[model samples]
Target: MASSATTGNPMPPSLSMPPSQFARLQPHAYLRAHLSPPSSDQPSVRANGRATSQFRVTSVNTGSLTHANGSAVVRIGDTTAVCGVRAELLHTSDISSWGVSQAPSKQNPTNTNEAKDSKSEDEDDQGQIQDLNLLVPNLSLSTGCAPGLTPGAPPSALAQSLSHQILSLLHTTNLVRADDLRIWYQPPNFDSEEFHNPGEGMEVDTEQSGGPEREIKAFWVLYIDIMILSMAGNAFDAAWASVLAALRDTKLPNAWWDDDNETILCSDDFAEAHRLTLRGLPIASSFCCFEGDAAAGWRANVIPDAEEQKKKKGSQQKWILADPDGYEEGLTQERACVVVDKENGKTIIVKMEKHGGWNVDSDDLRKLVDVSSQRWDDLKQALEQC
Candidate 1:
């Protein structure tokens, strides 16, 4: 084939873009614009024809940041999140003391905290174990991402909830088990080390309090931050990727106990680290609700725009976009995110976000789970590099 350009790059036949397509070209939203659903009259084709049960091109990059302990960015066909982990020193111990449900005598009866602190241990709290899991997700929308709009300086409400959900999930699930954190919950004594900051090495107590400072004890505090550079279908996958990478890159200062004349018995240094056991490398997948003729039948793989945005009782909105684009998301019928675990071959329903539900039968659910197992493998391969 004759080369269009001297290099691998193809020469542009036409430089102009249509108004509707060009209007949606924010930096982050560009992916959305490209993946937007096809017109009702035209058949839709995603990048490489990824069916509803399939995923698009995915890749993982690591060590993207140096100052942090561990860091990686996972790109699931353009939805990307960069995660960095920094270990600080903290006095952490686990002691379970039963608490009496006592309200501050003057506290408002409707205080939400009272309900939150109280434990129910339900699916909503899935993955959370009594541990110190701190996750911060930074989402900055950029007009620089899309073409015409002025990007907001701060995260929108949707972005805030994402950070809160990830942080809560990381702790509740025991993803980073607290027991593994080394210290048990206890009162800080002069002998115990304080939490280290981002720049500092592991916390170690020097013998400055009294006589010859004999003991050197340290606590490793971890700060995990994930930044969402773009938004597409799968946010959870990117979040998990960031978490895994950050831990792998993390490094702690060396610690040793020394006495007069005795050779060093043991030491923990930057080389040694605690990586998540990774008991199971399960992943989440989603399917946008689609409804074609049950009698006439459409391909189960493709989603169409039913446009079922927030229907009240008795509303007859029937159509929606499967794997909805950003604009069609609000109008989606039903969105189900399923998580599949390699261990024990178990698949759990993580969440459901949609109005009208479809294809809830066991066969469909089981098929989705089966598909997830195969689909999640690529993510696992990417995480392995960390």
Candidate 2:
């Protein structure tokens, strides 16, 4: 008979699990054990060693990419995002021609007449269809950004969802004005003597001659693209920050209609460029809910009943954590993101999103808002410095 050691009995090794599995199993406990301070007097810390309700250090850099009209790179803790803006000339006539045509003038008419009216309506509708997409936004996430993302494949659901959210915010917040993008056309100077004998070696000096009433012939379209370089957590916040920085740094060049070429001409002079007028700086903050024993310390502070607490000690306890990372995020059951813009000395909640099954109390929500307001101030100052 072989000895016990040589019997080939497989024994479960001490710490024989993958790092990901280790992170998944009792994630909160792992954080509290490794990240929190040994002293009981100190509060429990997150995986990144940040106190509860505190965000990680954030940084931003603007106008870094020369190819893009505007560009910015934002880093919040481990999450990083880059945003770029490209400007393209779009004719106003084309956009206005896309609107829906008016209904037929006559409700009831002969078949031939109705057919004629339908054809006319079709033509009018085609002429009236307006292109409402003035600002286009897209987000890209690839394999290197995170673990599950694949390379060169279709964008994941998370990327598509983030893109939609950004589009919604840009449209609803009124961040960019329509008039700022308009390019006015300087009409020809028919009164000038140069127009009398145009074929006889006479050239029309359009730049020097005072023309008729000017009208908007075209507008500049801004295409905003965001790429996620790294995603630890809170991608929405990082993406929004990058967009704000890039847009703030954008400058549109002076554009004019060229009647001779039948195209819009943009001035090469840098001095002729104009900056966008932003309504206000908007910032976002995100939070996650940590339930069970992970929140015992917080629950103790909130509920000051020794006997009641003892009775419910075995019950689940809940706490809110700000700026959670990937490991903590996996264990969290609920999340909330709030966007605030300061306007005229008052804080406005421009957008708010909540997900997951956990229900937050009114008091807890109020606390989250206060934290978000503070975070907005921090982010706004950082952006200004950039």
Candidate 3:
């Protein structure tokens, strides 16, 4: 071979790898290198250039769908989700388990205890909603939202799991009020003075008044559909945000039971529509614990005694990242979700879910709640703008 050194081709620029390629090939090591700096002077930062406890900015838009009773679009960083709520009337006659006894009949009893009995029957409003299956929520990922999500296939495990979580939160929080869904019918002259004061020189016939003066004839079933337009990461938070915004924007028409037709009817006046009265604005925040690679240069100490090992365990280098992106999610295994509601300037934890790793402890949970509270304020402000 000819002597190329003499020709001065000059070592063709020492080949270098890009940071993006390095992150893809060695995600764990790449993250560890950033979090565990070579010197104490260097600040620890994530590969995405976000602080460990910082979350992405959230933006929301509501009432985007005219056909849907309520609709909202939420974007958290690069991830985006659209939620739509449709209400359908479910007549009591259609429910096989519904019976006449469940409905309170008009009575002429002249005691306060009798009125208490009638009120007690309707106390379990949430129970009625659950028993009748009034709320239905479904989540689906778009085909191109992420890699490996193909079209025309059955729902993936992630989708199913997310849907289940959403449904569980909805039920646990009791966000929807049953009074907003219930449709009642009052017979003619039922609210007359005779009913208000039965013994005030007035006679009432139970047969003439038909059955119950006021009875629930139907309930509104809210079908909440959430679609992931783009899934960068932290799907649960984005999905929940969309759901909350959509429900806030949802309006149901004035509905009543028709006596002659014996069916639920909706009013045509737009002014008669009313928005849903949700219990509280609950917000969801997600985080992941990124444990440094075992073989990384940060952990070069020799194995110690049992007591020393126990002491060193607490000093392990791990980073708890808030609102991790897709790349960070793949590098981490430990994750947690905190759902919180703010009441009177106090943060109330509605639900807390932690799994996939044991690095998170009680103290860590408290920190997570603090971060969630801040995130809640940010998201709440965003929703309010819509």
Candidate 4:
């Protein structure tokens, strides 16, 4: 949420507070807008105090994808993503030198199956498999975030950025094990007539055994597609929470498949299929920064309003707000998102949302990490059900 004044008062120092308290406020001076007003769920004191540091409500539902090996739907505050992981059979005719398999013979039925399995697998694994990986992410802001759209409209920048971030995060973190994504290497990467090690090295034609043998390999690809059901700010954190939570509850079942080419030749009802194994869960946190006061957030445009509006020239600002709310987010300078993997014991500052916001110091980053670690238990318990 927006980082600014830790008070319930909406007025800024320039408008009401004395100059002496101004400097003391530092960044907090500009975050009044992020402070929630008194409400039934939150008492006035709790509304703008420690509770602000706390996250919005979060919920996770698993087994969302009937076809996917493992799937989850997570909703945190305003962010949500539906993550599904599917494992298919892969066949590889050209076995790596380090592969454990011994040379196959015509009498080997398993070898024969491998050859045919990979051949039967689909070649368009790239595109078809990718779509299966689409999962909702923390930053996903649905088209509904925009108050106006006459249908047949373009996606908002926020939505685009969210997709890129989610995919990049999963890719970089190796959340989906590429090796586990075994495609049945049926036809293999070649044909019988194709020459191998032609002249220079005097190659070998392994497929000459009437037909090439296929090898099956395991691969795990994660699809993270999130639809924004609401825009409660903190999309990054919300997405991260749901992803980790749902993954914990995910299961892979026994299913039929050809290991070669790593393609799903057919589908097996989940009841009888083996589920994907989840190693651990990773979470992300976001901080918002701004230049002017928090009150100016909506006016200047830092966060997405219930009604989306263009940001003011304030995209570039002098100061930074930490974890801004919708109001403070609009006025705040920029945002920083950090993801932490508890199982792997790693923390990554994903990207600096340098939208004219102030730069964060190492000390501030350390503080956020500490916060994420300490709160791990609570978040962990909340997601364990998923």
Candidate 5:
């Protein structure tokens, strides 16, 4: 007979150990050890050995997808996001009647009398409205990209929240002009139809009407779909960068009304397509704030000489990490996301969002702003080169 430990009913090593011992050896415990700081004297260094303020190497490529009207792939450190734009035509009659009217153009010079007449006509045509939902953006965060996501599951709350943020930034910052999507009715003979019936039917022949102005018949709706191929950190920054690149590469096909087919016809000539009017580039940067422990005098990684000053401290010290990775993000409790636009060499804050349990000092917030401005210049140059 053999001993029980070596018999056919032998158990695995984990099952042979006590429950308490097995619990302590869980994977969570091991991960925490690597992520958290061991002590105040020795701060935890980033896995990639990057400084607190330094960003990971970034790269961008455009026109990667042949099917898409415009496509781009952006990689920031380990995080990667791919964006594609699909342009579709929408007739004005199909849209809701409660849309906002388009603003008059200031590029063309008009006399006082003409301006007043145009304003009067615009007021009379109050039924016409412009669709604000032309640009639809969606983000898909799949399980293959990250560890936490489950396969075949619906979009998580985090993914939905990020999509909203990107859409809000696009609208609030005026990065893309709304007028660029409008498709006006360009008649073959403008002299003949200068003013016969200005605003009569949906398919009015402007050439026969003898009107000096062309009417808007249809417009382009851009669907921006973003996919995260990998998740390292800073998903927002990577997504926004991809959006900028895709929009820059977008070209709208030339469309005209077809009298025989009773539908709009698009020209096959790629060179005749027009480009979107991008007013300015708005770049976003994220920061994670690490709070120090009062009892242990444990300081964040960003603070300099924090260990030396442990002997002379009252309140807890906080450190700010720019472009934090997944490991750092998991340990941090506070975060700030800032979007800035550079206009004529001046930095303008497009939007700012801060959330956490800890209280942030005014001085620290100001420092974050200054850092974001500098990062914007770097990003702008990178985008221009791409």
Candidate 6:
């Protein structure tokens, strides 16, 4: 005791901190401690009581809205999204950019080769859905889902960016077929002799009275509106899952052009309605890379030489978290999302987006893709049930 006193070493009073308090005060340390067990005998787990590679439970329900053509609600963990698809008619005549005539006549016949080449060019130009803005996707995050979000205000940058991402994915995937949206009209064949020699050799305009002409008078424009009722994390995945489910459940009424009324009309019969044919199902999985360093975060404020401590650590640890919650999202800056689809007993990668960190390499990406495939199957099964 005398030697300890001389060395100025004194025993401090016993102290204890609650788990919730510790987590609130030192979130980075809390997560790191949970991920790293004190001994090898103990198993490492996440703060949410999940494994490193485990994903949240997903639920999908369709046809929830009576008025909408299609509707679905999807929940992933705490995140919930509701999607409604409303179809409106858009007349081709109203489109100023569409210069091509819908009906071709015998006298002013269109060149077959030129028409074929034009069709090819249009296909190469990424289809008419983009040109005509047929599919409109609106994602709203201002539903009081999370803190710091004000309702009824203009859309934030995050919401707009997510909306654009959804729209781009819809276009790139070619999920919706154009043929289903067309309202075609077969004009009466006026090529008969009675019509040609009507009223004592009156001049007949072949262009106006085209023979066996089929024209697209109008198109069904689908407006996909998605609302995030509750947001925990991974909002994109939830919103997209809702969209897929809603589109699958959507059934457009049979519509045709009315020549006498000079307008479009839809059948009231439910049997005549048809569902949109979507391409292969694509699912996205997101992962965040948590750098396993406690001192590099808030401790840097107290520890002036945190950089030196990080250097001395000799390569900081990293933990890849799958389907991170809101708390984990704030702790991690690096994120990667992999979109995958399965066809013909094979997994196909649709899209990959990675940013905010470079620790995730090709091998990590391949693993993420595998995870996405599993997620795709899970979502597919859920959608099939609806």
Whole-model lDDT per candidate:
0.49, 0.77, 0.84, 0.50, 0.73, 0.84
Report RMSD for candidate 1: 14.1
TM-score per prediction, in order, is 0.55, 0.73, 0.85, 0.55, 0.73, 0.82
In model 2, the runs with Cα more than 4 Å from the true position are 1-25, 32-42, 96-131, 186-214, 293-314
lDDT (Cα, tens digit) per residue for candidate 5, span 309-334: 65466564555788988866776777
Which structure is stronger by lDDT: 2 or 4? 2
Runs in model 4 deviating more than 4 A are 1-52, 64-69, 78-143, 146-150, 183-214, 217-222, 245-272, 290-323, 343-355
Q: How would you order the candidates by lDDT, starting with the best? A: 3, 6, 2, 5, 4, 1
Model 1 stretches astray by more than 4 angstroms: 1-48, 92-152, 184-219, 248-269, 291-333, 344-362
Candidate 3 structure quality by residue, lDDT tens digits, 1-386: 65669886666675788998988788788888778877889778888888889888888999999999999999999999999999998988888867743745322223435444423434465577677788899999999999988889899999999999998898888888787998887675665558688779577664454544556788999999999999999999999999999999999999988899888889989899999989889999999988765442223345345335645666567889999999889878789999999999999999999998667899999999999899888888899999
Q: Which regions of candidate 3 deviate over 4 angstroms? A: 1-10, 13-15, 38-42, 100-123, 189-211, 294-315
In candidate 3, the residue pairs with backbone N, CA or C atoms under 3 Å apart (3 or more residues apart, or in different chains) clash, namely: none
List model 6 lDDT by residue over 1-386, tens digit each: 47766888887765988899999999998999899988889777999999888889999999899999999999999999999999999998899865562324421235534443534543633466787888999999855899988757788887899899999988877778777787888676567555757767566444455456466688889999999999999898899999999999999999888899999988999999999877789888889999886445566678798768767877888888999999899899889998888999799988899998666889999988888888788778888987
Candidate number with the higher lDDT (2 or 6)? 6
5 against 6, candidate with superior TM-score? 6
Model 6 residue runs over 4 Å out of place are 1-14, 39-43, 100-125, 192-212, 294-314
Q: Per-residue lDDT for 24-100 in model 4, tens only?
A: 56434434433434464752222224343465566778777787555677776555566555433333333253144
Give lDDT: candidate 4, residue 55.
56
Pick the winner on lDDT between candidates 3 and 4. Answer: 3
RMSD of 2: 11.3
Q: How close is candidate 5 to the true structure, as a TM-score?
A: 0.73
Name the weakest run of 10 consecutive residues (lDDT summed) in model 3.
Answer: 103-112
